[model samples]
Target chain A: MFSELLGIAIIFGATVLLAIPLGLYLATVYRGDKSWSDFLAPLERLLFRAGGIDARRGMSWQQHLMALLTINLVWFLFAMLILCTQGVLPLNPDANPSMSPDLAFNTAISFLVNCNLQHYSGESGLSYLSQVVVIMFLQFVSAATGMAACVVVFNALKEGTNEKLGNFYDYFVKSLTRVLLPIALLVALVLVFQGTPMTFAGKQPLITLQGDTTAVSRGPVAAMVAIKELGTNGGGFFGANSAHPLENPTYLTNMVENFALVLIPIAMVFALGFYLKRRRLSYMVFGVMTAGFLLLLAPTVYYEMQGNPAIAQMGTDMQLGAMEGKEIRLGAAASAYWGITNTIISCGSVNSMHDSHMPISGMSEMLGMMTNAFYGGVGVGFLNFFVFVIIAVFISGLMVGRTPELLGKKIEAREMKIAIIVALLHPLMILGGTAMAAHLYVSNPTEYAGWLANPGYHGFSEMLYEYTSAAANNGSGFEGLGDNTPFWNISTGVVLLLSRFLPVIGPVAIAGLLARKKYTPESAGTLRVDTATFGLMVFFVIWIIAALAFFPALALGPLAEHFSLY
Target chain B: MKNNFASAFRLTLALLVLCCGVYPALVWGAALLAPGQGQGVQVSHKGRLVGFENVGQKFDWPEYFNSRPSAVGYAADGSGGSNKGPSNPEYLAEVNTHVAAFRQQNPSVKPGQVPVEMVTASGSGLDPHLSPAGAYAQVERVARLRGLPAERVRALVDARVQQPIFVLLGPSKVNVLQLNLALDSLSGR
Candidate 1:
């Protein structure tokens, strides 16, 4: 218990310690104020020249959005094409078959959006060529995509009524080369050292002393895992994800991967502080996020360590903590910590199966993903949080009897409308999809009978967790959901597209709209967002919004599950 | 717009090389510098390789320390958990059966005293290590079967228990395969 507590503390401490400096560096990289990466400047310029991208040609927020959308469209098409044709492709030594059209669509969008909600098992579902070309490719770009979007927000925020935000092409390329690549490289080396396989070999057959022949699947796992964690793209090389020995391997690798999950998201938060030159405001945002994180973490760790009473009733002593669906090496406390952190950061790789967690622990995980803004995914996490920040600012503006202005720009009906729609859309997709699934589940039980692997309240939780994970752009599942069907694939594909883009559009649109407005100076009447009062307000706004939208769903799922267990 | 499209195309191809090709090659190169060369630490018995130390193998015999129960029957290929909720009836039944089997195997140990790790399937079906408590619980069975003193076996289990990384990263665990090999050496098998 002490070790688990200490491990969580160290992980959280290490993330902040590493992120602060990395955040500053990222800020400098985004601002382009200095040329520390001058060595790569020639290569960057060459690529720009090759593509006819004038480095100085700035984009309007609309143009930036267009570029972001267009590139994503291209990726979706490319990924879909490859996924549908990977059967005949080289490097498929295992001869893995092509994906069905619906699965391809789901997978393509899943990777393109950086959600990576895989419906198919990694070892069997994809060939090596597809894994390298599609999965690994999307992991890098999807992460870069998020960071690129945030760079747009940074540019818009930096300029006071300036018409030109930075070029999307420039930001996209630079984020990949300058920021994500180096860190992933270092992390990849560490994983490889700790025994994650990087070979291109297929599954090796092993004959145990017990005379059982098992075929072990091996691939370029180390490469994928490094970026998968670092980029906040949590697609597993295997179905069990980080729980697999080859994927995580050792305690050292587990720490490395967990640290990697929150690395960029936390760094991006600090980057916001440095970029805006308002360190205190950044700290305020960080504080609220930390509070939300701890709110989820405390219960998850406590209940997961408490062991399932129902199991104890069955005459099995659970004094060693909840061992079901958890590794003894990681133990219960660290596993609980991983669940919270993974959901909070939108890194869905699990060292422990969340499906077997205590009912309340599952609830905490689902709630964390639903909020989706407590130091969320790569660059998009803050963008998601910023939507609430707009709503909070507008509401506080009304409360304090002042005009709603953020960073000297007025928050009028247009900005408020977009923010509200995007913020509201998450619950709409989550609840609406869940309703459809639940209706289908009851009305046509046989057709979708196997859709949910568990029955009753836990079954409902599985369905709820699926949509929640998708809408939040988090890709972890209860694992018990037999979700590799057309219904799930297409349904979640649509949800993934909307949930991912709308938030990006809403946040960047607000930032862009604000950037074009004339700068207004701060006055005594201005509500200070950096103050503790406003931070608390933001915290309450997030909690209130989550509680209102999800409280009923919670009542049916983990909440009910928890009560029934007792 | 066309220029922007062209830029996007060119950049994608460029990054494909850098990220996909060059990056993986570089990582693979660095892995060679590390011990075991990313094939994992293989535990061998009498020169023939037994198994990877990091991966779990089935050890159901009373004379040996039992590894964690696997959901996939210790298949290293498709490693996973018994993705069952705590309240699921099937999971409870399975646990009950596992408890019965454990009681049958270690008759001297009380039902309540049997550690949960012995009955539950791990997240990775291939959980190579067991908690120190899990290992210690089986010490008596292993000691009696091998005609060794329980105190000596306890010392061996204690010695094989690995402290968490830097004493704060993970839990204390004993690699079941390594412990069993030590037993073989002690028994002069």
Candidate 2:
């Protein structure tokens, strides 16, 4: 128990310690300031020239949005094409078949939106070529896309009067080359050293001691695992995700991967501090996010360590904790911590199956996705949390009978409208899609019989978790549910696209609109968001909104499961 | 708009080359310097490849250390958990049956002493290792079955205990496959 607690403490300590310097470095990289990676400037410039891109040309928020959407559309089409035609593509030593049109649509949109909610397993479902050219390609670009969007908002915040934000292409390219690439390279090497396979070799035919011949699929896993965690994109190289031995391998890799998952998201918050030159405000944001994260982590870890009371009643010992749906090598504490980090950062990689967790642990996982703003995904984590900040500032401003202004810019109706749409869109899509699934299940039980793997309350969680994962742009699943069906494919795909883009589009648009407003200097009357009081207020606002939005849906699912367990 | 689209497409092509082709190739090159050169380290017995050191295998014999229960029968092709929630009655029944089987195998040991990992299926049904306590609980059973002294078997379990990486990640565990192989040597089999 002491070691488990110590491990959790080390992981958190390492994340914060590494992220501070990384945040400052990323801020410098985005601003095109003189930095250690200046040597790569020549190559960046050449690529810009080759693509007919002028690095000096800034874009309005509309232009930035168009460029982001256009590039995304192109990538979407590319992914869909590759996925639908993977059967004929080279590197398919296993001769895996192409995906159906619906599955392809889900997969393409899923990856493009940075969700990576795979309806298909990488080892058997996707060919090796598709794994590299389609899946891994999307991992980098999708992550880069989010980082680019956030940097645009950072530019808006930094120079409040600027008519144009920085170039999206520049940010995208630099994010890949300067930030993600270096980190991925180092981490991938470490993973390979620790035993994660980097081979393109086909499945190895092995004879088990039981005399049955088993084929173990191997791939360029180390590379995928590296970016998957570094970018907070939790798509795995195998069906079992990081739980697969070849994907995670050892406890060292597990800790390293967990740290990598949260590093960029936390750093982005600190990057906000460095860019805005408001270190105190960034710390305040970090404090609230950390508080929410710890609150979720505490119960899940304690409950998981306590094991299941129901299992104990059946004469099984509770010693060694809840090993159901968890890697014993990771133990309960790391698994619970992984659950929190994965959900909080929108990194959906699982060392343990969230489906088998104690009911309240499941609720914490859902809450992490529902809130979707505690040190969010790569660049977009802060952007999503920034929405809550806007609401808190507005609500508190109205309560105190003062105009709601952020960093001197007034939070007008337009900004509020966009923020509300972005914030509420998460629950709307999650609950709406879940409701649709339930209706389908009820109306046509036979056709949708295999849709849910488990029946009753846990079955409802599978469906709810799927939509919540998609709507949050989080790709983790309960996994017990048979979710690769056409209905799930199309519905969750739509939710993935909507949930991913609107949060980004809404936040960036608000930032753009605010940047254009005349800067009002700070005064005694201004509500300082940098203070601890305002941070606590923001925390309450996040909790209140999340609880109200998700409590009923949760009540029917995990909450009911919690009571039933007793 | 056309120019922007063209630029975006070109950049995508470039990035695909960098991320997919060059990046993976670079890592693949670096992996050649690592042990096993990206292929997993295989555990061999008398010049015959037994299994990958990291991967879990089936060990159902009473004389050998048993691996954690598997959902997919320890099939590496499809690794996963039972995905059963704690409240699910059917899952509880399955666990009860496992407990009954465990009790039947080792009647001398108390029911409460059986570790959770020993009965519950791992997330990766192919878990190759067991917690030190899990292995120690079964030490007397293996000792009696193999006609070895209980002290010797306990010493073997202690010897097989592997520390968590840097003692800051995961828990102390014993590789079931490795320990069983050592047991085979100890028994002169």
- Estimate the TM-score of every prediction: 0.97, 0.98
Q: Which parts of model 1 have CA positions greater than 4 angstroms off? A: A315-317
Which residues of candidate 2, in runs, are more than 4 Å off? none
- Can you write out model 2's per-residue Cα lDDT over A1-566, one digit (the tens) per residue? 77877888898999999999999999899887899899998888877877788877889999999999988988999999999999998999888999999999999998888887988877779998988988888888899999999999888877455779988999999999898989999999889999888887887777754345777778889999999999888998888899888899888898899999899999999999998899998999999999999999999999999999878876766766788988767889999999989998888999998889998998899899999889989888888898999999999999999999998889999999998888778878988999999998989889888877677888899999999999888899998889898889999999998888889899999989998998888999998999999999999988988657889989999899888877
lDDT of 1 by residue, B50-133 (tens): 778778888887788988888888877777898899888888888888888877777777767778898898898999898887
For each candidate in the order shown, give its overall lDDT on alpha carbons: 0.87, 0.87
Best by TM-score: 2
TM-score for chain B considered on its own, for each of the candidates? 0.93, 0.94
TM-score of 2: 0.98
Supply every candidate's count of residue pairs whose N, Cα or C atoms clash at under 3 angstroms: 0, 2
Model 2: per-residue lDDT, tens digit, B44-135? Answer: 77776678878888888777888888888888867787888888878888888888888788776686776788789998888878988788
> What are the per-residue Cα lDDT tens digits for candidate 1 across A191-293?
8888788878787777665556777778888889999998887999988899888888887788889999898999999999899899988999999999999
Please give me the total number of clashing residue pairs in predicted model 1.
Answer: 0
Model 2 chain A weakest 10-residue run by lDDT = A207-216
